[model samples]
Target: MSNRSYSSQPKSVVIVGAGIIGATLGYHISRRAGMTVTLLERDLPGAGASGHSFAWVNGFGKDPRAYHTLNRRSLDMWYRLAHQLDADIGIHYGGEMRWENDPRRATQLRQRVRQIQTWGYPCRLITRAEMLALEPHLHPGDVLAASLSEADIHVETDTFIDVCLRRACEAGAVVYSQTAVTGFVVRDGSIAAVKTVDAEFPCDVVVLASGVQTTELASLAQVQIPQQQSPGIVMKTTPCVEVLHNVAVIHAPAIDEKHQHLHLRQLSDGSLRIGQGTQEGINRDDSQQQADALLDRARAYLPTIGDARAIPTPVGYRPMPLDGFPVLGFTEAVPNLYVALMHSGVTLAPLVGEMATLEIVDDVRVDWFASYRPERFSVRSSG
Candidate 1:
């Protein structure tokens, strides 16, 4: 860690992207006394994965102590952020319940539950009777084992982005909507200005928080940040009478290769948000077909959603790194350029913003972020 203190003089910082990560970073950094922040969005805020995310904020499946620890920390940070912003952000801490159908997989699931519990995660196995008692609407069909963790949170991501942006704007951060970063002007091996379609904005530092487009923007600065553009489809239903008991149900995929994993949760407005695995070559017709299929599967578990209609929504790409973890912190090739890209943007947004701001404004290196540096990918490319 570097022993650097916060600068007294204000730094002109430009952030490219107005998604949840960028917006939250702006909000946190702008709260400091000596920072001039500007957030640029090609589209409106939350127009990317943040908008379409299933938005379940939990560290249930994240592995490696460092990654899971960060997520666990962010889970607490979300409540604090919501309190500070005085906004609802649609956060529900009703917890999550997951079960396995196959008897063999149920044994593995029990082992996995023990592993996570040993790691200090709040998860425990429950019988089918207990699972049904917790969520009375669930149809427990041969569920050999199930786990429930009350530490999970559900969010309405678009509202969260809006609240973060609003607070950042209140703190004097300038926001530019529909303005895209076309290129970068580098000087003395450092970013000097961000070139947009209409004009160039001089900045002391540039933070690239763009999701799938992070790779394209980094290339302009001669930095390679590779990302896997995984396509995910989320199906929303028209508002109906509440049938779900406010608990999220996440089921293991069928072993026979005939059923896709199903994750279902209820929104604040009595509508159901159901999602499944990524469909690589999904087209318009295919999207509807997939949505119908997911709904049919959902009906098997929650019979109330059978009458609900599927609303048409565009699919969003998850900005997953090549290794399926986050790529955060500064780049070695470009000293003044920082990148924040990850798959669970919604779950990790607030904490990343707070930590990234500390590193950027105070020049302090966070020891935990050492593993996620962009240099990891650089080493991969050279090898």
Candidate 2:
């Protein structure tokens, strides 16, 4: 760890990745007074984990009161952000509906609902009749217990990322796609510029929001940001008739013991994004057979998905920290090198963007991120 004084207000800021977190942070930082923002992406915007995420914006599965509250705050911030963005932003906001079929899971669902309610989450148990009323198209086999997190919603990450980058560009920020960060130009224990394949971008701060590649990129700056392997797959379907009537997303129970739970959400274009198991579930099977099986199981719940074939998508690797929480704030090894790595990028984009801007532009350490600093990671010598 090194101590180097940084400008209270940084003018040249270089963001390493243009995913949801980087895009949102770019937009926020560009809006600040006298800030020149540059977003660097190796691929097209939203081409990484953000584009393939389940995109369920919620605090339901978050444990610990503080983390749950953090997610809950971001969950509500989406509404304000949508209004502020003043564009499509691809927000479907009818809330998330989930049900459990087995008796054991049903009991657990009820308990979980009660637990979040104590934390003041806008969720409650509802009767099966109410579930049908919300989504009449659902042919749920047996709903032993059901709950609705009224504030939860799903986002079309492509649309959101596009809108954010456009806004950032409009605010005089430059975005370079197909640009990979090759290294960092360090001088006097701080990053003086970020080196890409094409050119070096002079900067006062560098944000590592490069998803699964964050660890390796941070290593270039000699900052230790440990990450675990977390590969996931969320298959897509061809356009079909609108299935979900009122709810933004649905978590359907597994049909049998062989399969895991299924979650789905429909896009404005009438196509559905389907995935099995939990949000953090490990799945790398991108074969057509696996895609077809997921769609078939979805058809069992909503028959309106008629003739909609599944489109196999490549497996996406989430930027999951070893501890399974976010790693935010500037690193002690490099004071100006900020790290913004997290798993639930979709859910926490708005909060991370706005709050990270506060730290990056205003030069203040946000207390909300006090528990999630890069210093928590025990640095290992770079290879």
lDDT of 1 by residue, 1-383 (tens): 43222232439889999988999999998999878899999998889878877888888877777788999899879888889989788787768888887777789889888887988888899888888788787776778788888788888887878888888899899999999999998887888899999999998778999999999999999998897658777788887766667565455455356665677777878787887653232323336667777777888777876588878767778888888888888787887888999988788987899999988887878876888899887744554
- Candidate 1 off by > 4 Å: 1-10, 252-256, 278-286, 379-383
Q: TM-scores of all models? A: 0.92, 0.98
Candidate 1's displacement at residue 67, Å, is 1.7
C-alpha lDDT score of every prediction, in listed order: 0.81, 0.93
Question: Candidate 1 at 276: error in angstroms?
Answer: 1.8
TM-score, candidate 2, is: 0.98
For candidate 2, give the lDDT: 0.93
* CA lDDT, candidate 2, residue 306: 97
Give model 1's TM-score versus the native structure. 0.92
Q: List the residue pairs that clash in candidate 2.
A: none
